[model samples]
Target: MKEKNANSQSDSGYQRSLTNAHIQLIALGGTIGTGLFLGVGNSIRRAGPSVLLIYLVVGIFLFFLMRALGELIVSDLSKHTYIDFIEKYLGKDVGFITGYLYWFCLITLAMAEMTALGIYFQYWFPHLPTWVPGLITVAVLLFINLLSARLFGNLEFAFAIIKIVTVLAFVVLIAFMLLQGKSTSYGPVSFANLTAHGGFFAKGGIGFLSGFQMVIFSFVGIELLGFTASEAQNPKVTIRKAINEVPVRIILFYVLAIIAILVVIPWDKVSTNSSPFVQTLGATGLHNAGSIINFVVISAAISSTNSVLYSAGRLLFSITFNEKGKWNQTFGHLRRQLPQNSLILSAFMIEFAPLIIIIIGNDAFNFISSTTTSMFLIIWCIMLLSHVAYRKKTPEEELTDFKMPGFPVLDYLTLLFFIAMIVLLLFLPENRIAMIAALAVFVILAIFARIWRKEKTE
Candidate 1:
């Protein structure tokens, strides 16, 4: 009944081809992850129940940041990609950096996501070697992204639906348990748990702020909106619709989810290494809830990797297509309605990166988690910095319709939170290495970017 933007159309007449369902899942698939499911305990340990405060702080910053990006996206219909916004508002050099950096983030995280999928799989299929299952998991995502965008969208939609349903089920179970007075053997779980153990601010100022390291990672995929701009069926309405809902989702999914968990489980014994969803559900005496949640997490991991694989390819293709960039057209070739070469390379990076860890006999899951903290933070900082430049350069009227509510203030606030998260990483031994590794990678990329630019100039 709906005539949507067709991928078969050339860029000359290209429009947002993605349906509303695709857009919804694109955001949810990337946002709701094994990280939230499994990692809340580490967060609780990091800041006690104060982790909910961290979620609130970060959530506010992201809301404005997305609004800024949304304003830029809607300013001009032709400016589809985030790169396009940065390019117009910033410059081509900055554009290339955003493109390559965004692609790299996807590649790095995809590696981690694949490794996580294998780890989650082993929870049930213990007899299997990590590499075999990991490789297969990577393959499944690869095939899906290589398929038509609609196919990829359908798969992602289904996967995100499963995640949403699981979380909704958790909320329902929590309400049911509370309503029925399913008292815990240790104690009747209630709001008292928020402070009974150590109080909400038990971590005090530094610990509360530093706890952001884990908290920030949970919000990494919030920018999934920027990636989908080019494909969104109705950019203005869709972009606004997505931005309007983010604040609510962050509260319900992240903030409220934290409160629900802490209410059910005691603070001191929480384990971030496993899905808080699993333990929370299992505590409610729901049979096989843990295994079922693990299954959903594996699917979520695969879905995230798949969507990001496509996004990475698109970014690389954009970089190569621009004459100002160093890469050649062959790498950017658009064929059969897909950036085939870019897709192939993106898939290769995602799959191959993990294979190295598997071959080296590292813990596949830990290796993936290593990139979880720092990589996304690096991208988030760069985006905010880029936005800082963007606001000064672009005409005020262009951004007037959807401009950030508290310019300058919110911009700086988001920056502060991002840095706070980085600082929080130093307090976290578990994720410290990931943070260090991301910085080292950034240094390497910066050096190469200079060389690439020099070569292009020559």
Candidate 2:
């Protein structure tokens, strides 16, 4: 066997014991949980069964996006990830922007997932303080993050399993209910559920446009492929396989799951209480419906929280790699070649913010989404620009294995879609303030970047 060297340190202390099944389901878990579980009604209200169309449209765009990143990252065995590719294809300035913005994406994603967990626990322990589990969950994830890369991989594998099984089980139970001719006050299971109420696109053109924001939110963390590039056993093959299969997985897990739920409950009647998963399964009068989905969601949230910390911690580690960062070059070196110091720091900050949020007792979704919405848009913009640069820099011939299907057209559509999502966000009553706040965060981060650069020059 040839000497097997470790790649860059973005995967944290975790290494690549993850098998094909592990990577696929972990990718599934990263994107499928809390949002799809709970946000189904929100999507329906925006586009109705038309939201199913939205899922296909958005999933296609994400497939191209992931393939673009995967095509570039899979070339060498160095474990250099998409962030590294950004630096290589674009200038250092562009790379730094991508890396920093991606870091924000990771942490804010963690905050969002952790926020969901706190809310779930409050269901059972109604009298107990919300922050107690928030505090404890953060602590536990932080400790787990400090271990070697494979340790983290194993943990994510198990966490992702909980979600996959629950969703599959939920689908089966829905099928069973429909077969039994079950009826709710809403109506009975009938083929008409697909076409009867408002004829699929019940909300019309404007509602369909408005639904993309939540649809994009459902697909947020699927970029775990880029983050895991550093530790994939043979990213040359593993990342390729993972990225190549993006389209099918998105359709199967997200699209199919949504179809299952819509068939079981009319788009008009799905509840906002708990997850749509709970409402669909609970209708079956199965044993402990609330408890079953609550457990699945809890596991999904924990998996999301864990995966984000691992991905974000690695990006934090990269900052010190710059000659300008406070840590010496040695800081970039991981013991046993893992990202120990960076993981510790990233884990601390991630946990700290939520404890503060918990202490403040501001548990509303909009409160957290405001800070993150801007952060997410900023990252999306960076990734889009990075791809443009990649297309410009990389020669045409070596692009053989995989390239985005269309040059400027598909890429441009995806870009425009992201812009429209941001615009739609402004129209939302609860999210409107967040849209405004996100603008301010962008300005502040830009100004901070300028000042930091000036100080480096001085």
Candidate 3:
């Protein structure tokens, strides 16, 4: 492997304390968020068993997309992120828009995770205010992150292990129930649940398509692997191994878990008001299943919030480093190689999650969830476009062994998939407002970038 700048302590002037294990676990922690633990309930309700197919399809496309991302970063190890390549290949305007959008995007997602955390808390303390636990979640994660980068990694690793074990145990429990010919209200614990209840495509084509919106959203944090590239121990080997294993992990964690739930309890029994995992386990006579699943999903939410806050901080630090302004400079300050100022600012915005919950009450999580998913899809599309541009400009000799499969063709197809997702968002009544919000945010940011550029030129 090419080793340029590989030995530098801080390749991008940021601490590189994350090891291969940390990279893998952080990626896992990020991808397997509250989206799976809670949001899957809504998806299962929407499309019945057909949601499984949606998950599989979205996972395949994202895996290809990550390969494009991995190839670009490893090809030029010195660049902090694909944002750098975005500027080089696409233009300064796109890079500027994407940088700000990406930062704001993850911050918005942090808010959504915070909202989910508050919901999880309601499971334990049914009468207590959600904002209380929501506030506590932000404070706790903020403190761990402020301590150090390695601490954040270690914390996320622990969170990932909890979720991993929970899902694995879930799969095993469902299998045991099926082996004993256990039956529930929906019928026996068997694969027949997939087709028994109104058939596999029970909800028909539109219902199946609607599920894609949430299904795709569940994988929003998959690109977090690219974000951790700057801090990884061996950018080349570590990233390659992590990205290469995503498919298997997605299958084991997402696909199999969903299958197990539907197999044990019919899709109709999976309530939007609670976790499918909990509901399935409850069907099998586990009295404490609800509390157990509650803790698992809570950990998943906190894990995602922790990872995304770190991401937003890093993105702000990068954008500020490139801008020439006093506030930007302040936000870019580092202490012990941690982006302390940026993190504080990010945390302050995230703290709004509780207040939003208090005001909006019941609808807050779904609203933020749809908005976050829309923004991430936009970012993913931009990354693929940048990748296509990079391949055209670079010499074949410079391409790494980790190159994207079916290069330009797969790139455009993935972009088309994202477009389809956006269109699907328009079809869902709940997502329409969030979709409009995403467009309005983009337009406002684009105008802001133009003014910033004109001011700089003068």
lDDT per model vs. reference? 0.71, 0.69, 0.84
Q: What's the best-to-worst order under lDDT?
A: 3, 1, 2
How would you encode candidate 3's per-residue C-alpha lDDT over 1-458 as one tens digit per residue? 44434334555777778888898887766668878988999899889999988998999999999899999988887776677888889998888889888888888788888887777777777787877776788888888889988899899999999998899999988888888998865678899889988999999998898888778778887887777877777778889988888899899999999999888877887878666776777777777987888889888988888888888888788777656689877976577778899888889888888877888888887788889899888889899999999899889988788899997889999999998888879778879888878878888888998998899899
lDDT of candidate 2 vs native?
0.69
Residues 347-377, candidate 2, lDDT per residue (tens digit)?
A: 6666655665655564444356445655576
Superposition-based RMSD of candidate 1 using all C-alpha atoms, in angstroms? 3.2
> Model 1 Cα displacement at 179 (Å)?
2.4
Clashing pairs in 1: 37-275, 38-274, 38-275, 42-272
Reference-based TM-score of each model:
0.90, 0.88, 0.96
**Candidate 2 off by > 4 Å:** 1-17, 76-79, 184-186, 195-197, 327-331, 352-363, 370-373, 427-429
Best-fitting candidate, scored by TM-score? 3
- On lDDT, the candidate that comes out on top is 3
